[model samples]
Target: MDCCSPSRRQALLWAGVAAAPLAFAAAEPGAAAAAMPKDALLVTDAEVVTVTDSSVVITWFTGSATQTDRYGAPAPVPADTELLLGEPGNPGSTRTVYHDTAPTAFHHAEVHGLDPGRTYAFTARSAGQDAQQSTLQFPGTGGSSDAPGVFTTLQPPPGRYLFTLALSNDLHMGEQTAGIITGNWPPAFQQDPGLPPYPEVMLEALLDDLRKPDRGAEVLLVAGDLTSEAKPGDVARVRQLLDGWGTLGTDYFVARGNHDRPHVGADYAACTPIPYATDHHDCWGDVFPYPRQTLSVHQVGGLRIVGLDTTTLDAAGGTLDDGQLADLAAELRRDKDRPTLLFGHHPVTYESAVTTAAGPAFDLDQTKARQLEALYHRTPGVFLHHSGHTHRNKRTFMEESQSVEFLEVAATKEYPGGCSLVRVFTGGYQVNFYKTRADLARQWSQRTRGEYYGIWPHYTLGTIADRNHTVVRDLSGLTALRPR
Candidate 1:
């Protein structure tokens, strides 16, 4: 079936329902449920992903069927809300499977002929109750003469603009080992006590910080390794973590990383090297599928953000395949004039001796790196490539191009409780690394006699400022970097 066809759309709706067993239970009437008041409310996890003068996709979810009707002038309400499937806008009513569930009780509806740079306050209703109401701002253009509704609209400032995004990686949800996991056998794996399962903890803290009014970051891009061992339970845990943060307005995107694949064997290292196993492949597909890529020609003011899935090879380390690379090239070609930022799990290039010592090793495919570099050179917008793996704080500038910056992020687990906060402004981009609030860093430092290699000690500062012009910043006060 055509994936974009109407039938395929129906299938997507059913898939949502099949995955949510708890939603089904909540929908059922119970003795206790009868006592609770029933008011029509929109059951939605709605958030704004991308916004422009002409279009927007406000993604949301619902417990049951809903209706999108106009209440006041600019706001919408439920006219005749009920649990109905496949009725006009209600594509979710016909399917019994969980996937059939819709993000909202309804899907995308175009608010056509909208005035530029206007703010519209819209609400959703389910079971004849108001579910959610939020205002969306549209950037206006110069030539528009018509105004549709009495809403406030603002246009983006003229000339080039910069958008800021947050980068995080190697969450490793259920993984037991901080370093490599080597032991007698599978049963021996039971003996290994993991260093710290703090990925979730740090993620929550980092998110909380970002949600602050002053953070100014509107987009979040996770480079990959969201879970350890690609187990369904682990994937579910990661989902719960993200779902908890759904309220934040940051638009989130993710790419598949090495550890995100299912457990193949003790030797199975990167998700890109081997074909996925039977049960495990589905889990990965269901949780962290590849091509989670997003491209914004005008992300953040005028800059473009290109998110790539570099770990598409197999279970082992590999770069993007030829077809994916071609697609990437096409995308770059489309927006060659805009400054572009690349986000992915693997680095296009690196020169780290310490990471080389690790078993599966660090470094992107040399041939692929050169290919991508050539593409970047041809494309004017490509300025920075952000990656995370080999959990360490490091930055490398390609001498060949001098135009591209390769930034490696520290893992969220291990010693210095890894978290990086990135801010973009009209001047330039600033990245501040914060040590996790947990005392694990100090404890590890004391126990290892300064030999703690798991977490680097130099990122303890509450903030770090990066001037747009300088590639190197004085991190002296931020965190002391130990000599390699």
Candidate 2:
């Protein structure tokens, strides 16, 4: 799914509610009371997915009391429910069909026109059943369009620093099997043999860890590959998952990965290369269109954080074409005086020495690398290039060019399935990686942890002081790099 588009999952969610009643009837006797159904199966999986200053989307599932389908349609939803919206005094509603998908069916609603920093309660109901309500709060500061946070009117001192944000990439959301695969040929969508449901579990755990109050990841940057395949429905599903992060009090920014682009059809039988496909128009860009190779400039204390979309080029492999490279050069020149940090999906340099065998074929394109290196040399504050495609833990220094560090993060849905936390102080930065406790990963080990190499601790924290850079190592706090 594209990171910036309204989620189609929201639409599918409401559609699922139409079948909830049939599902409840199929349930065995003496099931949990919370599992009981009224008119629609009770909103079984109500969750807050994504939130912005003026809007938030809530998703939930409804189950049928039994498996019988009153509606004659094929795969008819067992139960039906109406999603009531608006404030308590005046509520608006929409109806949906609910399909029985084992555990339960889902319903999602995107609530808009909300006041930032205010608390709102959402309720779901079926016939004969009282509505189930859940509450969420919006960010206090920042413009509605800016990443979620409390915006401050006060300007920082000449050299003071602001809050820091964390960057992670290569989630490969739906890739569950352990095999050598590419865009040309992908594995079947059967229960990933390694783990029955790797993506779902790993994602839940990763989000849970990032939401911890102490982690302090004000904004979470998911570099790309939110899913293994760029199926339209899969894109919507990933959005539904990421939207859940809003409750954690962090704004999420996503970049498109090669895997996320519309490379396959609904049936996964035909392969449609990039910039093509009659049905999937700009399929990836429209769904998750933040901006191709644009800049997200934000002030944190005294620092200016610039997030770049380096993966805007064609889909043959991860590369930065003439246009994106030129855009980066111009952007750096425009903000040359500010203390800037760059965040993108692909790394200019590979970190783990072990993966060098893959060569540049697995890393950033040569032209793009050269452009970034030149920019770093000319720009004084371009100190860090944070990336995540290699799925390993290693920090590489650009020795040939000006002093800039590349910090490649691990995949959050496979192996460790964790995120990195970075803290920027007045003088330098401190970095730490946290593991995701996704239940799905724990239930299915092979898909998530079987081929895991164990987590790597003693993460490298690069410090840029005096506009000069050097590399140093400390292993005191290193974690496992393999699957747990």
Top-lDDT structure, candidate number: 2
After aligning candidate 1 to the native by TM-score, how far in Å is the CA of 393 from where it should be?
A: 1.2
Question: lDDT of candidate 1 vs native?
Answer: 0.45
Question: For candidate 1, lDDT tens digit of each residue in 1-484?
Answer: 1011123333333333232111212222122212224533334433332233333323232332222211111112212222211223344443211122222233222233435465554443343343342222222111222122122222333322344466778777876534332331111111113644445555665666566653445566777788776667777788778766652223666766766644444333323333333322335546544433223232544556666666633433546667767888998898686767787777666453223223223456667777888888898667788787656555655545567767766666443334555544343445544433333332221121111121222221111111011232211211211211
Clashes found in each candidate (C-alpha, N, C closer than 3 A): 41, 67
lDDT of 2 by residue, 1-484 (tens): 3232223443332233222221234323223324454443444433333333344444443434343222211111223334443333333532222222233233334445557444344454443343343212222111121111111111112222334356677666556554233332212123434654566676776677666654556567777777776666666677888787752222667766666654434544343334434544344555665545555655444455566665533342457667667767787788675667677666675333224223355466766676677778898777777777666545666655436667777676654456666655454554545445343552332122222111111112111111111222221121222111
**What shift in Å separates residue 303 of candidate 1 from its native position after superposition?**
3.3
TM-score (all chains, Cα) for each model: 0.52, 0.53
Candidate 1 segments whose C-alpha is farther than 4 A from its true place:
1-163, 184-196, 213-216, 247-250, 262-280, 289-301, 312-316, 350-355, 359-361, 438-484
Worst 10 residues of 2 by lDDT: 458-467
Model 1: weakest 10-residue lDDT segment is 460-469
